[model samples]
Target: MRPGATRVGIIDYGMGNLYSVAKAVEHLGASAVVSDRAEVLAGTDRIIFPGVGAFGDCMAALEARELTDFVRVAAQTRPFLGICLGMQLLMESSEEHGAHAGLGLLPGRVLAFPPGAMRDRDGRPLKVPHMGWNELHQLVAHPLFAGIPQDAHFYFVHSFYVEPANPELLAAFADYGFPFCAAVAVDNLFALQCHPEKSGEAGLRLLGNFLAWDGGGGPACGI
Candidate 1:
């Protein structure tokens, strides 16, 4: 991390590919530090939560780290970003395995894909895990999509979608079985269901926009 560059704290709560996410942040000219310590967290300008696997496992890991409170603070006090399962965990709860509680940063629940509703072009049952490039239809405007073109295709890999109680928070949506929340934002907090690290240039640009965000949320906190 070079001096004066924006430092992004990539929370390492025992999930997801932190390395690749770090690389993507660095590629956007920001420093990505993976840490769970409250002390290290105070040193960054923004934070990112990237995770994979089950929601129950993620909640357990967060509880073990004793960093849950700090994460909630970061989400409200700074520009926060969540990716994939990380995004799902930002909601109030998830139905992945029985019932699992999330960070409650957003007013919604993560739900499994409606079984019979998931179908292919010819009406065959689509696979459980939706994997591949899908187009995101923009429903709201935000700094996260600053330079990214509308209706851009992003790589997605998930079987769950967020049902936000406040529909105004949804930034984009993609249709599989039905339209599902693909990205969400409320003030400074943001989450993306697509892997910006794998969506090629368009994804990279979204990261770059995040790196360059200079809203009134907070001052540049050093890298």
Candidate 2:
């Protein structure tokens, strides 16, 4: 928990690519411990909630492990980060398969891309699952944006996106059919729809920023 010696706990509920995230954290000189033990996570300076797979399944895993409430409370105080499905799980609920409940830490819903991929102006498929790299337009100034170029491309792979009821939670966005909350930050919470671990330089810069962020530096809700 000490400055410049932060210990990060990558929550492993048996779904996420823990090694990749842990490697990314370790590469940045921060100690990374990938575990599911609540006591271990409580001792870390920050927590990275990363996941993949279905919304219901992820919530089930968290609940099964009894880590859901801990995560909700953690996001309210410490520097907590959620990635992809991890981010979507923060919403109140999702329509992935018959209105499944979520962590409800953030005010939003996870909705699937409309039908199939919408056609671009040039008549090409925009592609669902939003697979591959895309540009992110910075919506507001935040510590996460430090040294990151505006509109920097990041790797993404998902069929759904988050819609924060309070738009102020949006830190950056990208337009597939329309703009969606690509990243969100409020108080001590930071979540992103894209995979910073796969985003190359821009993503690494973001990870580095998150590692150094003091939680007080990010723009608060309602600014």
Candidate 3:
């Protein structure tokens, strides 16, 4: 590894999109280390928490690995990025399988989209998962979307969405049946409901921006 190269720790509690997220970081010229050990992760410059499973299950895995508190602390000190279910875990609680508590890093609740409330452009009932590509409506100007265009299409596959207590945390929204939180940014923490690793160029750009971010709440530099 090059001297002083960004070391991104992709948190692996057996539920995240580990390899793909690591590869994405490596592709952006940063060192990617996917591990569950707090000591190993603590050595890195940034953290990427990516998940692809149920809220309760993922939280259990994190607890099993004794990483729940580790993550909560890490987010405060590093440039933290959470993706998909990883994003939901940062909230106060989730209603996925029942009332399950979250990391409470962000003040909010993860809620399931009401069934039969969403309709396609053609007026057909949309699926619950809300899969495939969708347009992101940028609600706030942040470094995470520095190069991405407004209303850019990104990949999404989720039934639950986060509702933050503080509206200022909202970075972007995407319409499924109605507008929903697609991304949130606060201080050093930035998270996304969409899989930027799977969203192609725009996603890659976003990841690159994250790799270069200094957690200063300003535009990413040295990209």
Candidate 4:
């Protein structure tokens, strides 16, 4: 991949919103290709894992495509980004379906929000899906969020969130019933629990930022 041109591989393991993510990447001036083939990723500068389904189903799809190993290896060296369910899979495991193991790229577990933590300020159930725009407070700075405003609102639609074993990996957070990790980063790995594609301008800015990030300039982790 060229230094200024970003060719992002949108890993298609049959579990993500690859089309929407591809559009987002393209809107950001990057070439997005959807595939699970390692050859497709050979010359790519960035890898995007965009998921929109169950943990077990996603894992099964990746395993069937023989892309799990490739994903692990890529995250180790290249700039990696995961969205929504894809973000959850970056953790060590998930309790969503009987202790299913995750990629373990980050030290954490993907878990559902506690009942007490599912209500709004007025004590109303905030809904399991949590689908809408919410402000993401910058917990730690990363080049991916370079020009994003503080407390920028992003679209979200999920019942579970990642609980990082190491707090230092949390990059951004949001408050619903309480504060929770909405985005995380450890080295070149980044995962966002929200949907940047549907987030309008600020979200587009994020995608652009990711394309431009070299991963060597973010603030120290766990700030």
Candidate 5:
């Protein structure tokens, strides 16, 4: 690691797209230290909690690794970014497979896209998992959206979406059939339902903005 380099801890609870997230962080000129060890992660300047797979399984993995509490504390105290399933885990609970408690870092619940409620512009049914790229509408002027277009397309692949208890917590929204929470920003914490690593330039710009952010919910300092 170079001197003065920003060390970003990519929390590895064994259910995340660790390699992709690490590569994205390193591509932005930051040192990515992927670890589950609280001691090692605590030493980093920022945290990227990335995850894939079911909500319950991911939470169970965090618990199994004894990193649940560590994650809760780390997110509140630093520049934390949660991606996909990682974002869902920050909620109070989820109804993915069954009722399951979450990290409670944020007040919300992850709910599935109602099976027959979604319809396309043509009145055709939209599929679950909400796969493929979708346009993200910025609801709030957040630092994380720096340089990203107001309706930029980002890669999304999920069956459930977050519903924050406080409407003020919503940073962005996207439509599969109807508008859904795409991102949330509160203080030092920022999370996204879309995969930045797979979203190309706009995605990278978002990640870069995150790296330059000072956890103040203001404009990034510039990478």
Candidate 6:
């Protein structure tokens, strides 16, 4: 963390790969600190929530850390990014295991891919975790996609996906079985179902864009 560099707080609720996410922020010339303290997050210029694994487990961890309210408030007050399971935790609930409540920052549900809809072209099973790289189709313009080209490949590793209640909140979609919300952006919050840090050049560009974001919505934030 250099002097005058933007400080980006990466929430460590015992779920995310905080070190990798921290490295990504630092690679972009920003200060990335991994902590679960509300006070630390409050002082950050921006915050990122990156998680791996189950929806229920992630939410439970946040609840244990008493970060449910803190996250919701920080997201609205500054530039916020959610990655993978972190994005799904923004939904109202998850159907992964019975009915589990999330942060409810976004009005939607995290649903598993329908059993019958998990096949790729040529009628082959695409696997439950939809692993590897997939192309992202931009549905709307935002600062996050400024330098990134259209239909760029992003690394993904998830079984569940977000179904945002408001269609306008959708920023991009990708095909695992059919089109699913691969990324979402609205106001000061931005979330990605894919792992941008693992997505190579295009992914780094998106991170750089997020680092430069001024918390004023999209392109106007930087692009």
* TM-score result, candidate 6: 0.96
User: Pairing residues by index, what is the TM-score of model 1?
Assistant: 0.93
Model 4 steric clash pairs? 168-222
Prediction 3 TM-score vs. true: 0.95
Tens digits of lDDT, candidate 5, 1-223: 5568899999999989999998988898999999989999999999999999999998999999899988989888889999999999999999989999999988899999997779998999898879999999998888889899999999999999999998878889998888899998888888999999999999999999988988986433221
User: What digit string (tens of lDDT, one per residue) describes model 1 on residues 70-170?
Assistant: 88888888888889988998889999989999988788899999988998778888887999999989876677787888889999999888898887777
For residues 10-56, could you state the per-residue lDDT of candidate 6 as single tens digits? 99999898888899899888998789888888888999999997888
Candidate 3: give the clashing pairs. none
Kindly indicate the candidate among 1 and 6 with the higher TM-score.
6
Error of 1 at 5 (Å): 0.6
lDDT (Cα) of model 6 = 0.88
Model 1 bad stretches (over 4 Å):
215-223
Candidate 4: global Cα-lDDT? 0.84
Cand. 1 Cα-lDDT:
0.85
In Å, residue 120's CA in model 2 sits off its true spot by 1.6
RMSD of each: 3.9, 2.1, 3.3, 2.4, 3.3, 2.6
Give the residue spans of candidate 6 off by over 4 A: 219-223
**Model 3, range 1-223, lDDT digits (tens) per residue?**
5667799999999988898898888888899999999999999999999999999999999999999988999888889999999999999999999999999988899999987678867888988898999999998778888899998889998889999887878889999988999998888889999999999999999999998888976433211
Alpha-carbon TM-score of each model against the true structure: 0.93, 0.95, 0.95, 0.94, 0.96, 0.96
lDDT of each: 0.85, 0.87, 0.90, 0.84, 0.90, 0.88
